[model samples]
Structure formats: structure tokens, C-alpha cells
Target chain A: MLTPLKEFATDIRIQQMEEFKARGFGHVGGSLSITDCLAALYGGIMRIDPKNPNWEDRDRLVVSKGHSGPALYAALALKGYFPLETLKTLNQNGTTLPSHCDRNLTPGVDMTTGSLGQGASTACGMALGLKLSGKDSRVYLILGDGECQEGQVWEMALFAAQHKLGNFIAFLDYNKRQLDGYVTDICDLEDPAAKFESFNWYVKRIKGDDPDKIYETILETQKNQKDRPAMIVLDTVKGGGVKQIEDTTLNHHLNMTTELADEIIKQLIKQKEG
Target chain B: MFKCIYNGEKETKAGKTVFGETIRKMIEEDPQVVYLDADLMNSIGTSGLEKSFPNQVIEVGIQEANMAGLSGGLSAVGKKPFMHTFASFAGRRCYDQVFISIAYAKNNVRVIGSDPGITSAYNGGTHMPFEDICLYRAIPHSTVIEFTDSAMTAALLPVIKERPGLTYCRLSRKNCIAIYSEDSVFEPGVANILRDGKDAVIFACGYMVSESLKAAETLEKEGISTAVVDMFTIKPLDTAKVLEFAEKTGAVVTAENGNVVGGLGAAVAGFLSETRPTPVIRVGVKDEFGQVGTPEYLAGVYGLTPADVVAAVKKSISLKK
Candidate 1:
């Protein structure tokens, strides 16, 4: 049988590419980089019921790297949080789908997260709350490699470790690209897995777009972690599906026009038909 | 050393004789009341209550943000959570969480901020939240109240419980003078206008209530008949009463232990500027860092005392002239 999760993620990546193509210009780099991680979470591993967004026992998923909200929106639509048709209204005025997910407005999003480091801290609070109430529910937070530069992220790492919130798992989408330039040029976040591990978290590094690897690590995280939070250094490629954009020096959030949209849609149709 | 003091009396009871004492007492008589503390069981009068009713008391430990979220979670599952912590940390330290988790969700969570304002005493500036009630009142759907005495707190405990929306009770660590009689019941959203006059209204809350009363007496003897109103609920402020007093007097003097910028003065000024538009003078700690002192001395140094109120009235009157 075909792998449902891998196929589904590939489907969402195609959608992610198409949506940006429609916007002509959007957070293409970060969105493309985080698409597969979102797929791995919503498709294969995370236990969430889209119907009951406020379900007391449902697992929570927070996109800490909120600038890549297009990727998360793609996942939410495919998971039936809202109709996939409604996704075309993304970033439009009065649309519930903002550039960054607002938990108050959106259905599936667990917390409103636009500020770089605050989402990680907020997700940590949710995990801590779950543990306090003795709930077995888990929290999956995906952060951007560039966003890791925020000091509050490390503070949360230390807090989660100290609290023994083993139910918490955060994936760092290390696409090496930020708003202005490459992370190496800006300030190299060298060895994020080691940094989190040293901070007493059970952590691992993996190629982020490989849904199989990402999903496996997520499950392994829950099994092995007796105490302390877990961190996954998700090695991703900026603009991964759009081969022209991945790991490019100027790559971060790219804004394209109608012509670029037509060209990208052509490539996506080819990828899907094959 | 459970022998804490409130209203000049040694705080020893069923061991729950502090702010949470009345609630703990309610817990025994009524099964609906429960206590949730963020590792601050000793501070707000739940340290011993937990020992007696293990199932009823929840200790979320030193995480205020998490404690706030858990209060929402617990309340969602049908348990009333009276989350307690110091005024600053619980109110300001995690404002967003309290707004979202408890207030936005419309959960039955009462945030009791103990050691409010300078009552943190030797705990220094970090522990002392000089602007808690302002933060509490800022969030939408928040019902903020500061008790003047142990008697008021004892009366208001049941009042706060019967209502279901979000509420913040600012509690002081020091023993304040019991102002209201034992039978007095505080009406929410209603200002208790004590002594009325055609002069300026002395608006205050919490410890400032007693200090304002003292100031009123002193100002009265000085031939200035000042009207004093206990504006305990900072949010849903009795603007009608404040404006009537402001318009009749044509001058205003607000006293609180908070920064004058956001506390009573701002509320009164915002109202009057829109409707009455009177010459108002604010008497609070002038914009500066607060320090450790007795609640009385701190009130005096910060210009929340009756003498300061009298001075503020004189200045406001001069502006009217």
C-alpha cells in the first residue's frame, strides 16, 4: 500500500507551492521549509480531532515559527479543521487565516503565535499545564531556525527540562535562511541539537522534509523521554519543493508576481502528474 | 511562622485565617470552593487548607503562566480554580495568558493577587506590584476588586464565588484596619460613597480606602468638606458617581498605591475628559521606583495618605480658582 502520510505530505507541499504561486509573493522560503514538518505532525503523529478544537484532552500543536503560517494552514485545511476551499482566503482582509495563526480566531491552532519566541514559551505553558493536571496529552511546537536566536526559546528549554514536561516536543526547522540573510551570515545557530541537549532535553537531528524520519523521531521522542522535554533539529531546505529557491543566499520569504505564480503552478502540475 | 497579621490581629484560625481563610472556611461548609496556588500556599492563606483537604487544593508550583492556563483547564473540567500568587507576578508577569486562558475563555477562575502594591514589604520591587490593579482592570471582561479590610474580604469571598466571570482580588500582606462592620456586604459594580460634599471626591481602593478616609477627616477639619468614594472595582468603575462628584465639585483628587498614570486618575480623567471634563489632580507615587517600607510609611511617602490627599485637594482647588 502507498504510504498515506508521505503521500499526504507531498500533497500538502504541492498545495503550499500552489498557494504561494497564487499570492504571487508570500513567505515562500519559510513556508516551503516548514511544510513537511507540519505534514508529519498533522498527518502521521499528532493526536488531534479537528471537529473539537477546544477538546480538553486533545494534543496541541503550535507553529512557533509563525511567519511560515502558510505551511501550517495547508496542514489545517487538509486535516479538515476548515474547508480546503476556505484556504484561498488566506491573509485576506477579515479572513480567520491570518499570516500568523491567531488561536482565538482560528479553529485548529492551539495558541496565537506571531512573536518569534513567545509561541515556544506559550507552548511550554500548555505542556506544563497538561502535566499539572496529570493529562497524557502531548504538545508539538515547530520553530524556525532563525527564530531560535530569541533568548526566550532557550529559557523555555530550561523551564521544560526543569519541570520534567516529557510530553512536550519541539522541532526546530533549521532551513538556515532568515528574513535578511543566511543564518551563517547573520549569526550561525551552529549545532542546535547539542544546545538543547546540553540544556537537559532529549534531542535528535534529522532531515526535516523526510516525513518518515520526522515522524519516527516524534514517536521515539515520546517513548524515550522519561523526564524533560524533547527537541528535534529538523534540517530543512528553504523553498525545498521549489528547487530554484532552496538554500539560495537571498532566500527567506520571497514575494513573486503573477508570472512567477504561473511558472510555479506549471512545475507543481508536473510533479503531481508524475 | 503561620502567625501572619491582618487588620491588627494575629492571623491564626483553622490555619486558613489569611485571605484564603474565608474561602477555606467556605470549602468546609460548601463543597464548591477549591484552592489553587502556584507554590505560594504560604503567602495567600492556603498552606494549611491543603493539609486538610488534599483533593481540593491544587499546587501548580512556581509557574504563574502555566498556573493560569491550568486554572482554565481545571475550570473547563468543572472545578472552580482560585489561583493565588503575588500581585505583580500573577497579574503583570503573565498578562497575556490570564487574558486568553481565563478571561477570553470566560472561565470560572478567580485570580487572587496577594501582597498587592507595596504590601510585599521587604520582598523588594520585584515582588511588590505597584500597578497590579491597573493591569487587572485593563483586560476585557475582568472584574477587579481590592478589599479594604479582612471583614470586607470575608464578605466579598462569597460574592466573588456566586458570580462566574473572571475576577481579581488584590490582597495585602500587612494587617490593615478593619473598616466595614461585620455585617456590611459589598455590592459589586456599585461605589460606596461614604462622606459627601460639594468639594473634590477622594477616589481610592484597597489600602488607599482607609488612607483616603483618614485624609477626608483631616481635610474636613481643615474646612474642606471632601467626599470619599470606595472605588473598589477598578474595572466597571462607577463612572456616574465619579462624574457627578467631579462635575458638582469641579475638581478631582484620586489616591491609590499604583502609578498615577494608569490607576484611578487615568480612569477618572478618561471619563471626565469625555463627559464632565473637570480640573483633576492625581495623588499617587510620583513616577519613580517604589522601595520597601511599612504599608503606612510607604503610603505616606508615596502620597496616598490623608495628608497627601488634603494637599492634592488644595492644589486642585487652586486650579479651579
Candidate 2:
């Protein structure tokens, strides 16, 4: 199980890198950082039907930091939501895969979100709606640590806790970097886990790069969620798994020439084979 | 199917009360209909709705942005959400949320903004929103409706729910001058001609609809024939009716309780300028912030009374070629 999940994460990274290569420039850092969690969710954890993307009983995922749409598109395509070949058209003229997550254009994308912190609120709405209807399907929200600077995120945090949305699980990608600089330098989140806990949420912090940990935390929290929404703070590296991009500081968005993309892909293949 | 039954009297039930009743009925009939309020439930007379339908009513504190995004999420999951707040918060405060989450994202939701324009009364400048119509009108493929009376308010709530896309309903919380009978059904994008005349037409909505009628009455007594039109659905501006009146009368005056820059006045003038170059005068507030005052006092201050409409109508007629 762990090996297959790791392979899924590796494939997502490779596919997303190729998609970014097609665009020549894209949001690489944020997208790379959340690949493991996306792999775990789409690969095994989430109960979604690739055939029927709009099935009412399916679990929903809302990515608040929507600039990392390539990561989601890669996962969706690998899971057969759409043909993987469609990834070549990322952000091209009239492409279904936009630079940001849009539900209208993409299948398997639960909610449209681009303006930061909005997905948190929408996720809570979905959780509450499911709770009201007595449907046990869970809603998973992926938020950027830097995006937490938006006041709307905390507003949703307060709301989710107050409503006791046990079916909602939020994963905050604490990659320590945003567009301008490190999140601490820009606007320190101080202690996000403590903040959510103070807001009455059950909180946990975990190393985000491991798919095994990511998959296990979700299953554990699913059992222990007693009237409180769960918040899993992912301690991750910006531009994780790619040494070339990880070595670069300003990697939130990068200009990746085709040659550079080939070199990185070769390095990734070498690591996978070895 | 639209008809006018204005008899020169106030509506027995306030617009908010009628809205509350309609919301109650919608929830009772449909299990998917959910009503969300931003701590203004009592202000909009929906405070008691939660008691009867607790699962359907959500008071989302005072966070308008959250309320807007939450409604989009609700709509995505097949719950028809109707969010209400002051016009200030509903239109300006959470403009981006409504635009991106609900309208641009193609989420099915209905947003009700209470106390539009001078109807906000003592809530002062911060509470008054003279630009909500303009804000909502700019969104791509959005329905903007301004409720003129209790009958219209009651009649249109269900229609808005069944409509396919995003909708913004600007309403008054208090009583309005009666403009339609209880049985009068309304379809959006159609004009309700209250009084017809060939001399000139007064296009109005909200508080100005009754004021325009009064102005038309005064114009009729002076042997100058004038028409009064309740242009309730402002966005898809009854272009057919506007063209008919503009061609027949060769003169037009728009009256609104809000600013002339982007309200009914702007819609009418902008359309006529492109379609047919006719004489048009806007009777509304001109780039001014609201202040704490009675609706009547503010109308006097902002020149929104019948006399003002009458003056604008004469000015429009004088400019006609």
C-alpha cells in the first residue's frame, strides 16, 4: 500500500512538472508541496467515482490555494477523471484546465476557488449541508499556510468549530513560503495548530511528504472526530521531492524552460529506478 | 402577465414580513431550500423562521463574505440557499465573494439585500448602499431585481428560486407604496407599465416607482400626458419596453432611490444612448453618501420626491427633438 501510494505521488509530481513545462511558467512550489496528500486522497482515501464525477455520494475536495491547479489536474487525470493527454493544454487558450481551480470547467473539482481563503468557507458549507442531510460523506479542504493570512479562513475556522462539523477535515499545507517570501517574513501565522485548537478544532501536525502518514492521519481522524472538525497541519517543504526546484528560493512560480524540465524529469526517473 | 393595481395606499404588510412569509413557505414545500442570514434576521423579519425550520435556517453571524461563499458551497451541493444582509454588506462588502464564488463560478444562489438606498434609514452612511445595483449588474450573466412593493416582493421570491442562474434582489425592509395586486404574477425581464401615456415615460423602481406615479398624476392634471413604468427587473432592462416608450414618447426620465450613476437611471440612459438617441433625464442621488434621517427627509435632501421626478420629466420633454 505504501509503495503504490509513493509511486502515485511520484507520478503526480512528474505529470504536473510536464504540465508546467507546457505552460513554460507556472505556480510550481505550492503545487509540488501538496502532491503527497493529493496522491493519498485521490489514489486511495477519497471515495470518488472517476466515471461519475458528479455522483451525489462522493467525497468533496476544495483547494483554497487554487494557483496549484496543475497538481489537482494531474491527480484527476491519473485517476481517469479525464484523459491524461489533456494535461498538455494547461492554461492554453480555451483549455478546461485553467491556471486556477474552476468547478465549471473541470470535472471532479468540487468547488471553484481562486481568491484565497474562500474555499475554507465553502468547505464548511458543504460539511454542514451534508450533516444536515445526514449524509456521512466527508469534505476535505486543502489550504495554504500563507493563505491563512486571509481573515476569511479564520472566519470559517470559527464557524466550522462552532457548528461541530465532524465530517470536515482540513489540511493546511505549511510549506513556509508564499509568493513574495517566507510566510513568517510576510505575515507570520505564529502557531496555526494552536490557533485552530483555540478555535475549538481537533488539531494535528505531521510531516507532509509521506503518503503513508497522510493516508493514516485521515483514517485516524475519521474515527476520532467527535463533534469537532479536524485540522491536520502538514509540515512540508516548498517544492518538495524535486531537488532542483527545492534548491531555488523564489520557487512559488518559476519560469521552466523545456530543457530544464527535461533535466528534472531525467533526475526524477533516475531516482525512481535506482 | 404583469399588471399594476397601485391604489395610492401603503402595503398592509411590510416588504420584510412578506419576504419572511415567502421564505417560510419555500422551506416548508422544499427540503432543499435553505435561508442564510448575517445576524440581520430580526431586521429582515426572518428571526422566527429558524424556530420552525431549524435545519433550513442558518444565521452566519456578521460575516458577509463567509455567508456569500457558504451559499455558493450550499448551492454546489443541491441546497438552494437564499442569503440576506444589509445592502451595504451584501453588495459592496462581499462583492468579490459573490462575484467569484457565486456568479463567476456559476453557482446557483439567490442573494437578497435588504434596506437598499434610503430605506436603510437610521443605519447611516455605512449601512446605505446606493451602488449595489451597479455592483451586481456588472457581473456576467447575473439577474438584478429591485422590489418595488409587498406584492412584488411576495410574488418574485419563488420565481427567483426557480431561476437557473445567480440573482440579486434589492429590497426595502419596511412598507412600500402598493404597486401590484396580491394575485399579480411577475416574470423577470418584463416591464410593469403602471400608467400609460404617449407624451413621455417615467421609468422607476423601488421607492421611486410610487413617486413616479405621483409625478405622472401631477403631469396628467397639467394636460401633459405622462406614462409611469415600474422597471423592477433592472439588469436585462426590459429593452423592448424601453424601446417602445423611447420611440413613442421621444422622452424618458428614470427615478430610483439610489444613485443615478449606476442604478435604474444609468441602465435606461446607457441603453437609449446606444439603441436610440432620445432625451433622457436621471432623477436619483448624484454621488452623495447617505446620512441618518427618515426616508422622507432623505428623499427631500436627495431630491427623490414626486416634484423632483416631475421636474426631470419636464426637462426630458424639453430636450426632445
For TM-score, the strongest prediction is 2
In model 2 chain A, where is the ten-residue run with the lowest total lDDT?
A265-274
Runs with alpha carbons beyond 4 Å of true place in candidate 1: A21-24, A132-134, A184-189, A226-228, B1-17, B20-114, B123-128, B132-143, B154-169, B181-188, B222-224, B247-249, B315-321
lDDT of 1 by residue, B56-113 (tens): 6766566676566556545644566677888888877677768866777566788888
Q: Write the per-residue lDDT of candidate 2 for residues A133-159, one digit (tens) a residue.
A: 889899999999989999999889888
| Per-residue alpha-carbon lDDT of candidate 2 for residues B1-321, written as tens digits (9 for 90 to 100) | 656777789988988899888899999999999999989999888988887887899989989999999999888888999999998888888898999989888889999998999989898999999889988999999999999898888889988988867899998989888888888899899988888999999998889999999899999999889998989999889999999999999989999888887788888989999999998999999999999999999999999999998999899999988
Model 1 captures what fraction of native contacts? 0.06
Compute the TM-score of each model's chain A versus the native chain A and list the values.
0.94, 0.98
The chain B TM-scores of all candidates, as shown, are: 0.91, 0.98
Superposed Cα deviation of residue B231, candidate 2 (Å): 0.6
- What candidate 2 gets wrong by more than 4 Å, as runs, is none
